[model samples]
Target: DAAYLQQQLQITLEEETGIQSTQGEFKFMVAADAYEETERVKVNYTSEDTLQQASTSGTQSDNAPVYDSDGSTKVV
Candidate 1:
């Protein structure tokens, strides 16, 4: 999936470079060597289950929980 996304980005950048050249601008060229690519992995976690359970009543901090689209919370 990353390879596919990179290919699409390359194509879009190439088109931008061509358009810029036609406009008498040379700043839109893309340099792959100037970029660093890293692979990102998805992580599953729950803050309400992991942190709230560990906090005692009246001792909780002011930090609020962040929720995902599925309604699961994850502490920031």
Candidate 2:
């Protein structure tokens, strides 16, 4: 459960970082207790500048199969 929670947090972090350039560093602090109805995870993020430049580009590429006339497949 911890691993899955961490993965979700990482995904959230990446998304947040992508949208806003000011979000520099992120720190996750998880509590040890669990709840019956809903579980709350605390997240803390810090940045030196209120408005910073983008740390990385926002381009994504995937390797999908492409079909040719001869039924051959190529990755693109």
Candidate 3:
């Protein structure tokens, strides 16, 4: 039942992170001797890095701007 519980926890995680249930990838496993009422679970989430990288790349693209011959500045 630990594996099942882990899966349930993963679902709950998607709600908390706002990553969308289908957008992120997850791997969960019970990190205990067995499936017990007081057992602990281990989860490996692999999306935060991707999200961070995307945001970093997006910021770099913001530097692009239109140039004017009159030396005027404008953001578009």
Q: Tell me, by lDDT, which candidate is best.
A: 3
Model 1 TM-score (2 dp): 0.31
**What local lDDT does model 1 show for residue 27?**
36
Q: Please, what is the TM-score per model?
A: 0.31, 0.27, 0.31
Model 1 lDDT, full chain set: 0.62
Tens-place lDDT per residue, model 1, 10-34, is 9999999998786664332333323
Backbone clash tally for model 3? 0
Candidate 3 Cα lDDT to native: 0.64
Each model's Cα RMSD? 21.7, 27.3, 20.8
Q: What tens-digit string does per-residue lDDT give for candidate 2 at 13-65?
A: 99887866543322111222333113332211224232232332212224445
**Better TM-score candidate (1, 2):** 1
Please give the distance, in angstroms, between residue 4's alpha carbon in candidate 3 and its true position after superposition.
Answer: 45
Instruction: Give one digit per residue, the lDDT tens place, for model 3 in 5-24.
Output: 99999988877777553344
Candidate 2: clashing pairs of residues: none
